[model samples]
Target: MSAAETAAETAAETATRRTPGLVPVGETLRSAERGPRQPAADPGTPPARMPWSFWRLLGSELGLTFRRPRNLLMLAALGVVPIVIGVALRVVAAEDGMGGIIEDVAGNSLMLTFVSFSFLVLLFMPVVVSVVAGDSIAGEAGAGTLRYLLAAPSGRTRLLAVKYVNAVVFAYAVTAAVALPALATGLVLFPAGDVTLLSGTTISMGDGLLRIVIAVGYVGAGMAALAAVALAMSTFTEVSIGAIAATIVLIIVCQVLRAIPELGSITPYLLPTRFTNFDAVLRSPIDTAAMGEGLLAFGAYILLFGSIAWARFSGKDITS
Candidate 1:
């Protein structure tokens, strides 16, 4: 073969050798234009889902609620009140020699706990619970963080659920803040022994503590119901204070109505009226029927208010 022909043949051979590994310029341009290739999904595989961690969101919410200075201060005030009540009773008993219900409470630590609950649950507990629940959504909205929260993977319904659950948990915590301190203060200040029920029957100290536990649980349920009302109010406004004030006003109005003889028929349905049903636990046999009625009322309030809150919040325009 000629030299030129041999050179041409060698070049051809080299080009042929490289062709398998080399992409055509047109194919390269097209591939570049097409961008990255995604792997084909298998028919059996589930579709990709947004990562939503409900528990984590709840935990974070609880942490924020508990850590707030205002909330902590309120809890401190609740814890302190029981101590003040026990001390005041002890002082009164020492000076004036007490009478009637005061005499009973002065002589017994268990009775003192019940008395403290009686005084606090009427106003203090509902106030604190109202503040927390009323602030849940409205506070977020007022601060402009609510829209950002909604922007995340957390759905509105899930967010609302978390807010309500957090409020309920805080309600229980508020109840404990009262009961535990009252019990501790009572044990420190008064005599601990058998407890005399309102029915004139006596129970062991252990049984008395159990009764106190039941009372605390019942009171906590009542507070949770109140929280639901406050949460519903929260959904209607961006101002947290407005919601809080509205709930407190509603509570006061209900209490005023309950005091009127003319409203006797409606008193049975009032939420504040149910707050005192923990007294049923003071009876020897334990007034389960009355307590059951109170619990049913609480459940009804929770359901009604919860639905209202959900309805309002789901459609609320988050401009903040």
Candidate 2:
């Protein structure tokens, strides 16, 4: 062939190699059409972090817990019992002169609040706390929503923490449910004046109110510790009622042991024993040593049960 014809053939081959959709002599048509592929990500690169906030998850949990009709009814019951107690005491004072503890409550609204706390903290408040805390995990698992919650960006550890915190919030709500209504009823039905301590030392009304606040906080801490126990039990079963019942049964057994004079050695260690330690707040100088011991026991129970909950929840397979 002539030199110009040879050159023209070479130019045509080069154009074919560079053209889109046309495979080169050694390459596949798919490779030519697709072009160069993207490089794989580095093995050391961290994952794209989730933007979901912890507070939002906590808020959602709190809303669900408090909005349930059953929980609301429990709160209503807690609020009403104090009113009933106040009214009953008033009636008894009118019919037959109340003496001793009854007379104190009948005369002083603050005493009525203390008496209500004494009655409710043992069984009623624990029942409410157990109901809320026990249902935190088991209810979600039973409903088959727990898997979806875990599938979200929220980690198991964070979710467990949020559940416990939600329970603690409900525990405080329980305290207020008993406290506020009792205070209102006491003020309405009974006279407000200086509080006579169990030690018979009279403190000003302002001091009495402060002691009530302290009592509320102390009782709340005790309930929160119980909540940790219920939450741990919740992780072990998908049946919420089982967990709640078990917690209440445990409380009853402890109380029974506390009632036995022969079991005095173990009574101080029981959770129920600490529940009424709020009486320490009713003393003249305030029994800080006794209250401190009670608070310490509350903290120890929380740590022990909270660890159990974390261990069980973090490793468990989410079938539900």
Candidate 3:
């Protein structure tokens, strides 16, 4: 090569040298200059995020949900559980007569509350809520579908909201499943008319129904809090099983505490035990102080865990 040509070539080579941690722009330009022009990002394309629509996200989630066996099993349980339990109790208790059941409920809010906490709000419903919430976002990340969802126009906040709603809805459904059967059976078999309450009172069916609704509502709130806890755990784990298992362990630990003698005293101080007492509504005069305390404790749990989970989720490099 001629000296003049060599000097020019050396200058071009020096211009194309790469800088650390950055693309070699000059070299890239040289190569691309000989190639076809690239197309710009399409404006028509949806935003590379979860579409903020509530039901829209739910649609995507439902599709993802139906494809999985775990969610389906949970749904099935939500539907059939109440019917079965109600039927069985109806049959067995029929031999003894509804009179005894009504007597038990009449003037006995503590029994009702104990039954409520023991069965629905305390553990079972919380587990279901946590499973759905914990699995909603984390399961996607675990299964490598989170990127696709995040790209679908839904933002992290919207995604979390949808999951929370789904968890609440499902939790309500599950509680009704467990409760309605018992309630309906109790109503049909036992005379659910004006009944005496623990507080030396009598209330008509309407009043009792109102109390039931309120108690169920608290159950829903407790479930929501537990769901938040599970979701927090989920952010830390890709494996849905780990999230669900962790939630179950948290519940089991509470139940074990409730069973121990002196520890059982402290157990009532625990939110789980507090959540278990729905029968308090049936008492002549409902004692809601403990229930109130439980709800507040659960609320605190929801705020703390939910904030952490949201921070982690929103701050994470979600492309993976």
Candidate 4:
């Protein structure tokens, strides 16, 4: 071999001897220069997480709710109220004869709605909201299903938001349940004509029907606030019945306090106080002020109690 070739061979042999089984310097440099070869992703490793959809959760909850016999019975009961009222009123009008305010309202289907709503807003609506709200979280916990729910991919806050939304939807459903039956019974039993406003101005039947819808919506909004309050109470206890009873008691206390002449100032702030204010829909000019105050009060209540519920629920340890 030539002297230069022999020298190159000797250097290569020395390098191979010095670093036996070692990678070449060039290969090592190339490896170091390149980005890290991420350890092959473990096939067993879980995929990245995504939040569960609130609508999907709500829809599931609604499915469970409507499937319950108690819920169906409650709806049936609300539906019966208008039928009973219509039959009783018809009997009274036929026997004793319509007179005074009764004579004025006898043939007015809209008036029947007003009368039914007056009674319903005072008791039935609140009771329905209370029952559903009390069942929202407490019922699940009571039935030991809360643990399974918490095991879902959704976070506590998202779960709570879904529950609150469910309660609101339920309140609206209950309100509609009451209003629709009353409207139907009124149309069947009485005459649909110009509605006499509380201000004594007459509005077209179409306008009156629109106002009735607005009135139903207002009641639903008010019931939604009550649902928030009941929901907050529900979170603190696992017993659904206890939660429901407590909510009813609280409502009764508020109503009693509101009735006292001495507490007139604070009565305006009471939850039940604004429920009946939907009557303002019957006013000629449509007393927007009364409705605005009622809606504002309901909003405030929702904010206050909904915050309490979130705080309580987020920290709650679900053993069930």
How big is the positional error of residue 250 in model 4, measured in Å on the Cα after superposition? 0.7
- All candidates' TM-scores? 0.84, 0.84, 0.71, 0.82
What range of 10 consecutive residues in model 1 has the weakest lDDT sum? 20-29
The reply for model 2, stretches above 4 Å from the true place, is 1-52, 95-97
Ranking by TM-score: 1, 2, 4, 3
The residue-by-residue lDDT of candidate 4 on 188-261, one tens digit each, is 88888998887889999999999999998999999999999999999999899888999899899998998899
The segments of candidate 1 whose C-alpha lies over 4 angstroms from its true place after superposition are: 1-52
Give the Cα RMSD of candidate 3: 8.4
TM-score of 3: 0.71
lDDT of 3 at 309: 84
Across 1-320, the per-residue lDDT of candidate 1 in tens digits comes to 99999999999988777543333434333443443466998999996443346788999999999999999999999999989988888888886756877788876799877888889998989999999999999999888887667755567777899999999999999999999999999899889999888898888999999999999899999999999999999999999999999999999999999889998999999999999999998897999999999999999999999999998777665667
RMSD value for candidate 2: 13.8
Model 4 misplaced stretches (Cα beyond 4 Å)? 1-52, 95-97
Report lDDT (Cα) of residue 145, candidate 4. 81
lDDT by residue for model 2 (1-320), tens: 99999999999998667553322223322332333465777999874444356788888988988889999999999999999999998888886755987889876789888999999999999999999999999998888887666655466777889999999999999999999999999999999998889999999999999999999999999999999999999999988999999999999999899889999999998998999999998998999999999999999999999999998887676666
Error of 4 at 100 (Å): 5.3
Question: Which digits, one per residue and each the tens of the lDDT, describe model 3 over residues 1-320?
Answer: 99999999999999777454332323333332333345666888764342446787677666665566776676566545544544454466546446654345433322243243444555667777777877876787777876655654456666777776676666676666656655654555444466566565777757876887887787777777788888888888778888888988988888888888977557655657766555567565676776777788878888898898888776665533
lDDT of 2 at 216: 96
